[model samples]
Target chain A: MDTHDAKKPLPRLTPDNRAFWEGCREHKILLPWCQYCDRPHWPPGPVCPYCFGDDLTWKQSSGRGVISSWVVVHKAWLPAFAADIPYNAVQVELEEGIRLTGNVVGASNKTLRVGLPVEVVFDDVTPEATLPRFKPR
Target chain B: MRDDVAIVGIGQSEFGRYLPISQLGLGAKALQAALTDAQLERKDIDGLSLHMGWPLGADYDRMAEVYGLEVDYVHQSWTHGRFVTSSLQHAVMAVACGMAEVVACITAISFTRELSILGGPGDPEGMREQGATHGENPVYGLTSPAVGAAFALQRYMALYGATSAQLAAVPIALRKHALLSPYAVMKQPLTLEDHQSSRMVVDPLHLFDCSLITDGAAVVLLTSAERARSMPNVPVYVAGMQGVRSGRSEFIFAPPGLGINQQPASPTTPRERDLAVYGRAGIGREAIQGFYTYDAFSPLVLFALERFGFCGPGEGASWVQGGRIELGGELPVNTSGGLLSEAHVCGWNSICEMVRQLRGMAGPRQIAGAEALQWGTCWGDSVIMRR
Candidate 1:
């Protein structure tokens, strides 16, 4: 049983996600836009699933939304998450109408509300990694 | 499709947190087990279907080499949790459509290195570009199926007030059944308190709520039902099959609050649509003997039970609150321990369990020698219940 929860601890950047990370580095949340449907997407994508369009563009976000759902982590299956035992994990529905799941910093399950207003912030868990985390507006 | 394809044999590798087995080795063991169970020589097989799981990239080629057959026909269907039933359906359809006489379908995981915390390992360039559904969900808390299932579990609570004890029943009855299942992992007595105390990967879905990223494999052998009767193992017939999908556009949706109770209903879900997986057998829910479902998430078992007509909508809470899904319950499900107690050999274990029950070899998990078995795939893509 090589259950090595050993942390190699590098956020390797791949080609498809490169531009998205670049946007994050510049403090701009971005999504891929398909020329076919003509709407910006939360997650960067190549083919527009709705219209089957391949042409896409990355667009910036206002980074605003209401908490559609949330849960408090009292436990974790891996050692990477073991230290942050009591954290608030949330599914925030952005103003652009994209719903995403992430951690809400400076809060716990007891304080999370279904409709709490939130804004995005970046936390570099590792030097090579800068992840988007949310907080109370 | 061939109206008479039946599962004549089934087998699985020992499952657990870790094991010293190659994906190919585990697959060969399971394939050999099925061959022995069916009492057929390896030369009898011609068709094959393999789920391209998160194992070694060369699974299909390696399996073909070890099994000593130049596979005549093969199917590669892959996806998340509900993939087990879906994979079996592909194998059956291959046989049904006149592809081959004997077909073996399997899934295997051998290395801890192959497992990905967010999603199964895939071509990075091909994967990250997958859009809102796969892309953003992973970046958020849903990187793992357990986290993805937590989203649904939270909704299950808001809708039916489903309790932790009720949810624990999914793993508890399973572990009890695993006492009889030689291949299952996590079989020790685990209480709701134990589940409550287990580390939570995502709230609502705990460690136990998540299926193991195990190292093992399961294989099933199928042939025309008439041929199966002459064979030694109990003959189980292929009954019905169907597949369902929700929020097909962008993966994320607020699940519009139709009545504005200001809340979302339990997802209408792929498994919820009464698509006819068991309709071909002409057996109703009450007459159906055994049920095997994909349990990538703990809440999915309950979803299948409620959606598949074991109980009415929103009655999942009362359905498995105690020992309802165990051996003596009105319907016994996941007798081979499902994905929770069993290893996560993708969804292959569920197919093997279904065959085991139909053959009356389920031992401790056996449900009074059932004549029929119903198995749901990829939530509800297909339900192949047979007698």
Candidate 2:
């Protein structure tokens, strides 16, 4: 592997977050939903973020969302992402009432804008890591 | 504790790179300068509150050893350069409550290298989960501090139809003000065309939109109002100060006034928070002659303008179209060029400038007859300082 490519940071799989990553690896979008509050939270944690309830469940999302905001990063902070300079970083508000950050692939820079509709596409960066990306609907 | 506390002196370390001197050395320099500016002997200080933005600097314990300050009150909290006003509030509370006298509040950043504070996927998951830029931001390449704020600016422009050129005025104007400050990092003039043509770190946020990464430190000496009367220098009273966290989670791309919303927004909005501060101080908007909104990102100036009722929501672009925020304008903000132009000493530089302006000591950039000043962190820390 190229040295810069090797520098990409991978998500550490844990018992609480293993299911979400596994779902992504299988090309499915899974989010943790609080059974107590009946709302979904992104970036899964040990307890329900909203209500602080331990009663949580995972449900598959439709993988559909709209671009609430976005940016084109010209400078690369991490050498691993140097090759991806001038790439688009997008914030997508999923139908599940949560927003996630990812690049808008399969779309040109000029074509990207706020409220752009997109769907998730998982990209396997490493053997153990499959990162989720987004594409124009 | 309103009007009970006052800042007697302010000091700063040389900005930009300081590779030869350690971070502790830089902090000690600022602490000593503050004491000297206040004309207080080393033994006079009985309280200490240290605000370290970057972890590369010395902690409170080590700083005390370096400065030889043994105090009855001591506090050290790591704020991510977002809430230095809260650190000042800590010192004021200590002095007002009689816990200590002659409190020193200092914020120091001692990064000598070109390292960015932007954390990437490599950051501990615990840190990444804190929201703001870290929460759910790793995916979008929201890896850098500038990127998160850039996203917010994009949303604000999209919602309010603000042009990139209008927003560019902020940094350009700040550069103009920076030309007047001896401590400013970028003294060269920044034209609107230059800002527009500059490399885009994140779209709608040009290179000028981002703050400079420099090593610098600023300190403020706080004491009882009664003690301040006897101090050598003109005292800038801490009329009122307030810090509020809206929620545990922070959202970088959220719209203005809504970004970084803490849960239960009873007093989280800037207007509410400003009113709270002004009410406590028994002052109003008419009394404020200087405003120093955090300029970590220029778009924040727009947010502060609207939040403080300087302009209506979505009217910030038009409000600052000309040199409205420049010196001699309606309300001069960040007269020290703020984080954008002056050394990014967190918000301490703003407080320092406010004190000097009130004391009629800020050369060239001083706003004459400046009686009242307001400065704060973008994440909801408001302070009212008066002459």
Candidate 3:
């Protein structure tokens, strides 16, 4: 995928989530880790969800996980995706005990299953966006 | 507030697609009918609890203005189906606490006109700064609430060895109920073959598995039990209630611990906290004569059954089979077709059906001596009503 399709919906980066997106742009998966509890939370919240600690750090992840759940959307809910009918979306439980949503490339939709080991692959969909997709390990 | 507040009347507009009437017009029809049913004048309505608002339906201020209702209290939530119970609960609390004398729970939807907001680039909900509550991540083409349900169902099938054939029981039963309902959108009987052969909208979710996108409105009137005694209609008492659950262990479309989104992966049966509504109602789950849930998707019906402990974890697929959830079954659900087969009035249609069942007025779809019914959902909020 190239950086020309401007129709694709991109995540709205914010102060709480900008670091995570910046890390993705650098082809690395960064998670917000609670400095107090030493735990990682998802979606890059301002404070740790578990302990509500304001002191947090962005740590690089292994970008490897097992598919906790997956869905293959058959309908083109978005015109940008109308040509890619039946693409697979998955929730991968990263090794750091958190989950992330992305697509699974380089595999047939039929092959998706719970607990399938996978690793993330970055796709710079646009100049300012690099999506983290997964592939079978 | 068990049995302290009562639903005095229930009314609905004609349910269909692309109705020529505006949302407020549909709301007016239903509100007028509700006032007539309750034998109360519009002046008596001092409170408004609306579950529908901007982008899909009229807001409370607009409804009150257009309907000529001068109210002293108002409760309004975002335009989401999950707030159906919360909206009604607000009405009950308002009336019970004397914040208002008579509260009207109003829901009017125009889904056909607002179809773009359901998904696609036009939908901003999935593209929120922190993601959507229903696991919608549009960046990956995983948009629409249906995709959230599909994600949960696919994982559920893999973990429990359930199949698409077994999931068909939900829509099939609801379709059977719809055939009996005069106001149902889906008139034709749905067979297992139809469900199996329907085109897949998302993996593990056939087109039949999703709820219909249509237009309609429903209204329920609530007042103190003391006032309800003087009304013309039989009062359906608000027996007990619980609010929507949320946390790391909860998913909007799946039972607790089913592990969609950030929910913990450990599978769980219905815990005591989940069954608190029964105890608050001073009744057990066995006394629930019928079940009503937010059946936005067929998998939701199964998840609701499991959420209420009607069946054990992973047992909803098999438990819903063999007409178990149809009328006259072990426990009928959505006796008025629900959102799947009926119009998607944001589950208020089912709430109205519950009132009718409790009043023994549900022609051809009434449960025998229907004394108590439950309006619960996969998300864990519930309101039990009894005659």
In candidate 3 chain B, what residue range of length 10 has the lowest lDDT sum? B122-131
Expressed as tens digits, the lDDT of each residue in B317-381 for candidate 3 is: 99998889999899999998999998899999999999999999999998999998999999999
- By summed lDDT, which 10 consecutive residues of candidate 2 chain B come out lowest? B259-268
Report the number of the highest-lDDT candidate: 3
Q: Docking category for candidate 1?
A: acceptable
What does candidate 2's lDDT look like per residue over B285-313, in tens digits? Answer: 77888789778788878777766677776
What C-alpha lDDT, on a 0 to 100 scale, does residue B344 get in candidate 1?
A: 75
| CA RMSD per model (angstroms) | 5.3, 3.0, 1.0
| C-alpha DockQ of every model | 0.24, 0.48, 0.86
Q: What are the per-residue Cα lDDT tens digits for candidate 3 across A111-133?
A: 88999999999998887889999
Instruction: Return model 3's CA RMSD, one decimal.
Output: 1.0
Residue B244 error, candidate 3, Å: 0.9
Alpha-carbon runs more than 4 Å astray in model 1:
A1-41, A47-62, A72-86, A121-132, B52-58, B77-80, B111-127, B131-143, B244-274, B309-314
- Two-way TM-score contest, 1 vs 3, winner: 3
Per-prediction interface RMSD in Å: 6.0, 3.3, 0.9
lDDT, residue B139, model 1: 34
The lDDT of model 3 is 0.90
| lDDT-superior candidate, 1 or 3 | 3
lDDT per residue as tens, model 1, B1-387: 424788888877777656777767777888888898899988898888777544354456666786688778887665345455556777778778778888888777753646553442232322344432322243332344454456556655765677776788888777777677778776587787998888766777778877766788778888887788899987777776665444432121112221111223335432334545555556666777767777776777876776666776567768886677887876777887777787777777877777767666767677785777777532345565455
